[model samples]
Target chain A: MMPIAITDPDDPRIEPYRAVRERDLVGRQHRFIVEGEVVLRVLLQQSRFDIESLLLAENRIDSLSNALENLPPNVPVYTANRQVMDAIVGFPIHRGILAMARRAPLPPVEDFLATLPQEALIVGLVGLANHDNVGGIFRNAAAFGAQGILLDQESCDPLYRKAVRVSVGGALIVPFTRVASANAMVRALQGASFEILAFSPAGQEILSQVKPARRTALLLGAEGPGLPPDLLAQTRTVSIPMSGGFDSLNVATTSGIALHHLKSQRS
Target chain B: MMPIAITDPDDPRIEPYRAVRERDLVGRQHRFIVEGEVVLRVLLQQSRFDIESLLLAENRIDSLSNALENLPPNVPVYTANRQVMDAIVGFPIHRGILAMARRAPLPPVEDFLATLPQEALIVGLVGLANHDNVGGIFRNAAAFGAQGILLDQESCDPLYRKAVRVSVGGALIVPFTRVASANAMVRALQGASFEILAFSPAGQEILSQVKPARRTALLLGAEGPGLPPDLLAQTRTVSIPMSGGFDSLNVATTSGIALHHLKSQRS
Candidate 1:
């Protein structure tokens, strides 16, 4: 696959790479930008997305020949020098690699839940608007072999460039879709026979005391206003048991700890 | 507890708060800058540091009256408008709070270890250069009640501004000190009668199978090039069983999981 030379930063062919920081990806529902060679490799392997095109630093093209050979020939791979690359992204792009990818419409919450195995362990995030937390949770889900992740409407898009990078490409691999609210997520999981467990600092039971059922769905909320009291009442409440009365673990870290207990400890 | 008014951004008394990002904090070994009202409140309570002074945005002063009353009379609090605050910090300073705190010299690693109780669970970090990871680990350490954290010299300063913010002021609460290298960190912990456990992907034993001793230390490395081969050989290698053979969890997340097991499982 020969690389197309992009001499001008404003080349219409590579318009997708322009001034990325200012553009809110939320409005661009079908498309997301992923940066760095590591994440780009993961994007190429996933089937849920199509690689629209790839923009690379001129010097990186020769080294990426092996990776390029595996990519579909129809995907346009554009090469730009440092100056043009910097101009397109509106900053010094570190890995000198970027890929514009298109996501297929996600299946509805009920439809997606039906695809999971009977013993599947899933993570449901509620009102987590921060991209870093969303990405980190996916990374944790991937590490522990979680079957899928469910996100509420208020959660940020996992594929946001910064979130994808922070997840270290986990966002590209872990299967995920969104639901309407935390309550809706709980109902769908229950309908699928998954035991809903809501985690919060104020919960009654310590984490180690909670026995994960055959199919468990761990629910977590944002850092400050933790899992809703009403929502928690409807599910088994488990807490990490702060030793020194420390506030709480970062949401991503919380996901990793809970997922490890359910997935690895059970195994 | 009246606030000292600073009409000019160039006031020499507020010199400590200027251009924080550009300033070489590494050279200023004894002093650290903490930002945001949440972190500033934590700094005020910790005895490990002396409050040099505080610089606040004028609009925030009246609201922080209750907190202001708790400070010692000698501590000078400066107030400036939004324009002056932005000029000093080289960006939009949120929550209009900043503190220059002076840390007393850290005790020798060995000396610090002798101060802990008979049973202590500590997290040892090696070659973790990212500030967010360092901060996140401290937050995890605090959440799980780890006795202390020992960082290799290759790691970034936990007191770094970004790290302190990400830790949500955990860096101020958790006790930590530094050593020369990963090897030294392991040796010091071992000399203090700690069961050294180095966490890595290539380890033979599964995490749940490993037994914790009366005194234990969990050693973690950077994401890509994990604990060196020699370091792993020196300690008992315990691994997290990844069912999907996925890449390892983030170092901070791993710390939270491992520390939680060591701290809570025994209880």
Candidate 2:
């Protein structure tokens, strides 16, 4: 790895490493940022992504030097003082490491679906805005062996820095694709002969009672206001049986539980 | 409700709500500081806890005045400017509403056990430090009809601000008690004639294959490093069957799925 010294926060070369507030993350040119050692390590290990550059505080260089040695010799490693790093990052405390990696190209939805096995469990996120929950769902989807995660356009970026950190790097491993609209995605999946199962708190059939189909697509909405009626009408609704007095589970937790149940039944 | 005008952040009258960061919330003295209108409304509905005081920003007073009208006439409401509120609260962004309430007393272990039916599924937290996961577990526990929650002393405080918020006030309603230690808690449950089961990724029996018992206590630990070996040895180990490539589910999500499985079998 080539080490470059950066004495100023305003250094033009460190633009990619600048503080990522809400707006900066949404722009078309710059998608998202990745922070901390674990997530960076995962990104490096994955052959899919092209890491732009690495930034580390001068004090942290010695400690992380061994890990940095694994990077390709051509990759640039930028070093800055703790104060300069803190100023540029906006957050006073990060895990002493940051990496800018280009978002990997998502496979075409049609091509992605074609690669799955006869029986596949796919988690579809619709209008969910929480990054942590999105990351958690991805982590759970991977853990339960879901085919892939499908995200709607309005949903928060799954590659957001916080999402990557919260998922404990699972976001890097899981296969995901962004769909233009929930309706369009549902139509596409159905056209591919997939059974679209919408998870709802007020559904007619208990989740356990639903038999596993050949290709299952589980639809999960945001926490507070669940799947829109029009969206629910597009798919079969299934409810997880809960004891009396409890209303619902966290969206991410609910998705994880449902994925686990669906995987066990199918297997 | 009695309205008190406070121009100072260090007033002795509002000391209970001051320096909440430095104070230890474990003992009986301090209660969790709940912010935001939605959560406060939920707490007000619960008759078990005593409302210490209510603080509202000056601008928000008009909108909240009508809602405050329903509060007891003797309840004190503090009104302050944004700057004063920020100075007292330590955080610049105040959510317009804050409430300090007395923590409800927990029932003795024996008394709590007496209330549970013979066939019960209960969740116990052992050294789980994350407040969000703790709150999520409580929400999941309640949703799946777990009789109660047992928390080891080392576990994060359930009444902390983030935990309460993340739980959507479910922590206030869920029945929970802190045990001195995981070992003692396991022994206590055994003495009560309950089957103690610890969730492990490497467990021999899948959750579906394990025969449901009349009374079962599900033990869960923190994420990453799951249930400790000694804890796992003392109890029956069960695994949530996953597909070939996946590793493990989030601790809270796992609990929800396992609780649902256990409850479904009983029903």
Candidate 2 contains a number of clashing pairs equal to: 0
On a 0 to 100 scale, what is the lDDT of residue B23 in model 2?
Answer: 58
lDDT of 1 by residue, A144-198 (tens): 8788889899988888888888877788787899998888898899898999889
Q: For candidate 2, give the docking quality class from DockQ.
A: medium
The candidate that wins on DockQ is: 1
Tens digits of per-residue lDDT for model 2, A196-233:
88989988778878887889998999977888889888
**Weakest 10 consecutive residues, lDDT, candidate 2 chain B?**
B21-30
Shift of residue B178 alpha carbon in model 2, Å: 1.6
Residue-level error in angstroms, candidate 2, position B5: 7.3
Q: Model 2 segments beyond 4 Å from truth?
A: A1-15, A20-32, A56-94, A245-247, B1-15, B19-30, B52-94, B241-247
lDDT of each: 0.84, 0.79
Q: Best candidate, lDDT-wise? A: 1
User: Residue-wise lDDT of candidate 1 within B184-222, one digit each (tens)?
Assistant: 887788899999889998887777667789899889999
List TM-scores for all candidates, in order.
Answer: 0.94, 0.86
DockQ of 2: 0.62
How far residue B21's Cα lies from its native spot in candidate 2, in Å, is 4.2
Q: Tell me the DockQ of each model, to 2 decimals.
A: 0.77, 0.62
